[model samples]
Target: MTYNLNRWQGYGHDRLYVNAGSRKIGWIDLKTGRVKVTSPAGWPSPIEGMVQQWLASNGLGHLRVKLKPRKRGDEITTQEFLDRIDRSRDDDQQPAVALSIKSQRRRSNAGTDLAKNRAGSAAYAAAQERSTWWRSLGRAMGMRTEDQAWRIGAEGEQIVARTLQWARLRGWRVLHAVPVGARGSDIDHVLIGPAGVITINTKHHSGQKVRAKPEVVFVGGAAKRYGQAAQYEANRAAKLLTAAAGRPVTVLSAVVIVGAKSVRGSRSAGVEIMPKSHLLVWLLFRRRTLSRTDVDELYELARRSTTWQPS
Candidate 1:
């Protein structure tokens, strides 16, 4: 019996693709001279196109790469396929699976709610009435209000640009505001190294006030009670990401919550929440703790970690 990597499940399917080959994974279509490849639904482009740019370490760039197709004579059984799936699933993956499920549900619910509120809240009833159909054309489908999120994200972009500049002054290349996934909201500042990838989540809530403890941080003035949400979210994001990545994607949860009074000190629920001022220094110093292999891996992983669904 022969085995196959089930593109759908990302693991071996319960049943082997027996008689399916000696199958061709990728081949140059004889008539058209076009490359024909097998790909999973999750990927947008063809497999050949997707991995075309695949490169190994050594500061080398993308060279033409392709997957070798299977021979047409192989065969595999159902039991064998299930066994392979079990064999492939590592123990560390459980956490990432859980995290992905949670995130998926949260965003799913948020999108559903947004769909329910189609009418815009403008000043006049006439505008609301006239805009009903157009309002239906636009709606949020995420946990955070997209508009506010973008504005806040823009603030974050500024902080990243400034902080990255500061880091650059100290000889660091922190890729700021790059997307880890297709969603525009899902972005992270990345530092790649042998120790793995460290993705930073930046939040800018200026002039609120700052109070901190290891378990949580409170950033606001009045009856202000900021929970450990940001830190928790960061930690969760890291864990989930590591799992989804199917490798040891080391993640460091961080928050740069800007506020009045040039904040000082450091604390985390399980992360490092600090001022934007501290980010450059912390990252610069942390650079010493990693290795060259880590740097390369981090850079690649940062680019690949983005996950998205096709509409």
Candidate 2:
């Protein structure tokens, strides 16, 4: 009653080895329900009857079983055959449910740290009693408070999020302030839709000129690694999502400059730089690369905080 099963590498469909003792007597084409007997010359009638009965009980009685010559090295152990069948079945089945992600309680510490620094600076100035007037003047001129940096970044993220909200109407899903890695690094926004997944990095420079040229971005008059950072974020997101999806997931990178006096750039270093007003239009008109199913699965993976955290 032992069975030796082996996958038919030649066949394009599911093929199971029907074994008796240590020999392969036949192969059952599970997909077509057509059984082929390889060693029919001395095959036991009882074993054949049993196979036929099993197939009939399995609603494959309509299939015709025929005799054929045995191929070399077709014999395999019962356990091996069973394992092969199990793997084949697993490969054919789709996931019954989506992965459940646990909610993360961690909030952004960057904003809090900035606020603390601002408070500390003001207290230090007050204690000095001499530089207090200059510090107060600096504060009035927007120099004493370093918290403006965080506030500006947060404002840019909010603007990008609001702009991306239009994507929901177009069957897209957007996740804002997605935390990544053990460090405080985060993707400002992620958009998943028919066009594919895009990781957005927001830069807010009010009334400042922005310029980008292949691998370099300049805000106001200072150079920054905005393009490189966007590319890195996109790559990290794609890797995490590919693992979660059990398949390849492509991710694109973008940089949105909010309230910039002017924007001038092409896709430099694989990251697109543009004003916030154009983000929605760019996303909406890109060539569709994902279907509705892909969008749903990718969105689920992107929304999961655990996906980006190190194991």
Candidate 3:
């Protein structure tokens, strides 16, 4: 099959993205001559030969190495591929290139958060159920269920969301309750700005002690995988945004603990775990990485519902 090649000049490296119709099959690194086949369709011998022919015709035959696809993915559904391609085209057709700095700044103020408040809604429902006299008696008697946990979780998310609002005033973009895949799973909060992208996971432990080690976190003496989950969310976000922007994107993960009586220990893996009180301070102290223009571009791309939709 014939493929379209688009040259992307990145920092210290250049790549040629290969697209078959609307689907991104793979990409080739010009610096290392490495072929990274992202989709399975690009693995066949015929497709590799075609890529080689293109390299040879362009006077870069020396860069055509063996067909060893380092990465493989199952992201080639016709409907989803076409949908993403159409969204990409729409974005290109109506880019923010002509917008003046003032206008771009104004645009960033709109829709600062995208959460649907699913947890809050559920928490409200649970509260309503407990409002009855009989239910109130049960609650006062110290009876609870897993469903009641939503209330505490929702409260924590609200606290964290409020704290993140400060970042937007400084040209940072924040997205709350970022829905991931078709399942009901979601990333608690996403902060993008000069300090780069961070996926935040909120954990609520009312008056409980918490500690973070290099691998896991201990909540009231119970080991939890909060750090790993935050990291996973960050990784997924990095992958999605990288594909959408057609460039490399890095993501950081953080876990915010709300109502914790005391917090001890260090960061978990590559994830940062801290109490809610320190979230704003920690965020503000991060080193600046992206310019105003880059932040706006990435924010626009990320805010799109289609960008976070399942593939």
Candidate 4:
């Protein structure tokens, strides 16, 4: 016997909603063709088995039916089902779902560290208190260019992080703000997957025009050392990871320019320069160089503190 299925709007796309004489029964995914039984308790075992047989005969036997327990006074209307689907879709679209970065348990606060060191110095403390108002006034007047620069950089890193989180859906592993070297410098992000390893350096240049040549990158008509820096970061990561894994690790460098009005650059100075929006697509299409095992090994090594610390 053929079962009539009604198409209903689901979280990401359309789904097939099953009904038995106006009573809601279950739903099936339109894309994956997966079936779900909503009111399993309401239907008798014989009827459920028959329905399952019918679905299997209709070429849906490959997918397993998800059974949900029936609750008292629990009636699922079409509108309620649609609402639940919408909520699920929204949750799937969140960036945090894909961005799997292992966070450090004990984090270092640089500002707090500095403050602690100055606690015993009365003169420095008095000076710091007195300059607080002047500093605030300067910040209010937009004279704190250094602070603004740091804020822009931080914002760019966050955008890259969100983008990397989305990449997790495509089988990419990402670690953000990874500390390396002895001077407290950090690699903005490290990505490992089928495409091998990549060290991403985020540069936030809002409303600025960027141009890249073979050896130099110009931002807003001023030459910047972004390409050289990215290459150095990649090399450093490769050296550290190679030693930790006891195998050769090839690291590619990518510089993500955020909020640039226009970016005119390709691979120069062993670094790939692109705008923030295109980073995901670029990473997805790269030739696969590492297997799942290699990716996992590299990711674990990158996450360890000893891997980055100087010998």
- Supply the TM-score for candidate 4: 0.58
Model 4 C-alpha lDDT per residue in residues 164-195, reported as the tens digit of each score = 87899988988776767667577777889999
lDDT of 2 by residue, 226-295 (tens): 8888898899888887776667778899988889899998666878989998888998899998866467
Worst 10 residues of 3 by lDDT: 94-103
TM-score of each: 0.44, 0.57, 0.60, 0.58
Each model's lDDT comes to 0.41, 0.64, 0.69, 0.65
lDDT of 3 by residue, 1-311 (tens): 56687776643347777787787666667777655555533233334456667778888777634333212342233233334435645775421112233333333333333533443443445556556676557667888744456667778888887888887777678877776676656777778898998888889899999999988899999999888888888999999889777788899999999999999975997788899989888888899998764675577677765677646
lDDT of 1 at 87: 45
lDDT at position 84, candidate 4: 51
Q: Residue 36, candidate 3: how far off, in angstroms?
A: 34
The total of clashing pairs for model 1 equals 14
Worst 10 residues of 1 by lDDT: 9-18
Candidate number with greatest lDDT: 3
Which of the two, 1 or 2, has more TM-score?
2
**Candidate 3 — which pairs collide?**
none
The backbone clash count of each candidate, in order, is: 14, 1, 0, 1
Best by TM-score: 3
